[model samples]
Target: MKDFLSLSIANLLNEYIFVYDFLDSYDLKLKDDELSKSFREFFDSLDEDKLEEKGLSIDLLKEQFVNFMNAMTADADTIEELESITIVGGVNKYGEPENVELTIRKGEVICIVGPTGSGKSRLLADIEWLAQKDTPTRRQILINGKVPDKKRRFSIDHKMVAQLSQNMNFVMDLTVEEFVRMHAESRLIENADEKVSAIIDEANKLAGEQFQANTPVTSLSGGQSRALMIADTAILSRSPIILIDEIENAGIDRKKALELLVKEEKIVLMATHDPILALMGDRRLVIKNGGISKIIEVSEEERQHLPYLQALDEKLVSLRNQIRNGEILNE
Candidate 1:
């Protein structure tokens, strides 16, 4: 607290714009020349009559300022770095033991494959809630190989997982740049403009059709919206675990999106039906009867087949574009 009080006004404004805005709320705008002065010095320079007129003394003003900043940014320091997540299996839907224990480390991609309604989403929910034998599945999830504290598990501010579903729609009346900047500001990220630009650029690379920074988020197609979100989550979100559900239908570059998340060293769990997507994972979980029936490691042959699948996917994308452009299919 003392250190914060002694910081120059310029330093405080640079690090916490909320402080500047807080003072502005009280109609206490500092002069440009006062930027070099510390908060304590500024308060000391105020006359007793002025302080009394404002009904707040120097000590009271400082206390209120501290409280306001803390209230506004309470969640800024809550998220912690993650190394791995371990899933201790529980019972299947029929009350039979699942008899599976899976550990996924940072930078690893695990695919979940099963017919629809096979409880794939249940597994994701258990991990998202950090289940401690409490959820319906009764599975236990351990963070960094140990059960997380209640604050880490239950606190909304301490998010440990990021989920990207099949559908992404934006309702905010802000441009793409404005949306990313709002997130960056909330995180108090330094060089926010540069970070926002980088995120948009990366999003365009993953999107099938490129978009400009000034483009309204509401105008983005499904693919563009998903691409933006994937890049934003990979770059800005502190969550270490990323859960993706059926990204194949998102109309974006699925491989590049996964690569981006993996490059960020996040633990990725994807529930997918696409054979190519399943093969892209280091391991695939086969679900049946609401239980993990089997875990299959990507075989050497499967890895070798990835290129052919990707080429075919590219051809399909090309055909889709041609059709959208009103070109007739040729023999």
Candidate 2:
């Protein structure tokens, strides 16, 4: 059991660092390989001798580990569960996905934004398949009261969730309408024509001025491509939870497109670098090094504060450069 806890901690640490490294590159533009390596080497150096010197009893450690794991299990309450998303208390000395607690209410637009290498994608994946048994790694993921057995497909109770990633490709043979209709037919009921019509209308509205229903998706611009992908995901999947990655591609007015999606009140978990999209979210989670560093509530206060702060910082930097280049001087 002591060995088990130690091993679990090591895994959690690795995941944390892995997530951080990935986000660092994407969000902060930092190459942190050397720092990550040092951390890993430091962790690897810990041994049983070090454990004994710390005065931690193997029996006590094992008991705590079991208790921690149990807290992450179904027995924990909702508040207890959401608390797990905060990295400080939920994660143990050894790296394990224990005590993960978060309940994303229905229809809230939640944005997961962090620098590259920060675990935005991983966090999105975790939320999509929270607390499942057979996840690639044995991280704790719980849905409602049960551990989602990895073999089971539809485990989480939150309505069917749809994920629209940057890389999901549309096959050339299928026209845009055909692709969306395929999903509409399956998810909608016997009286789906009205819903289908509404979906079409909504999709068209969201597609911006340039899109036409019959347009072969292949001919669409990059922005149009992104809009169509979003339209397909929004209309086709009946699931209330939608996960999108990097919606702010070069071409599209992704911010407006997302605002339309968010208006529907679906539980949206999106990862992007765009500050505009991040600001639009009801809640913004900052992920780094595989752990959540800060969760900013985009309330009236934050809405007013963050943009101003960022702009001020940018202005200061610009001024500093100008002064260094003799663009301005104390006279």
TM-score per candidate, chains pooled: 0.79, 0.55
Quantify all predictions' global Cα lDDT against the true fold.
0.85, 0.55
Q: Write the per-residue lDDT of candidate 2 for residues 173-276, one digit (tens) a residue.
A: 55566656665654424555665566556656555446665777677766667777676566555456688876744445565567666665556787766665
Model 2 residue 25 lDDT? 30
Task: Give the Cα error of residue 317 in candidate 1, in Å.
Answer: 2.1
| Model 2 misplaced regions, further than 4 Å | 1-100, 132-160, 249-255, 305-331
lDDT measured at residue 317 in model 2 versus the true structure, 0 to 100: 54
Candidate 1 lDDT over residue span 51-89, tens digit each: 788787878888887777666566546555568888999
Clash number for model 2? 29
lDDT of model number 2: 0.55
Model 1 TM-score is 0.79
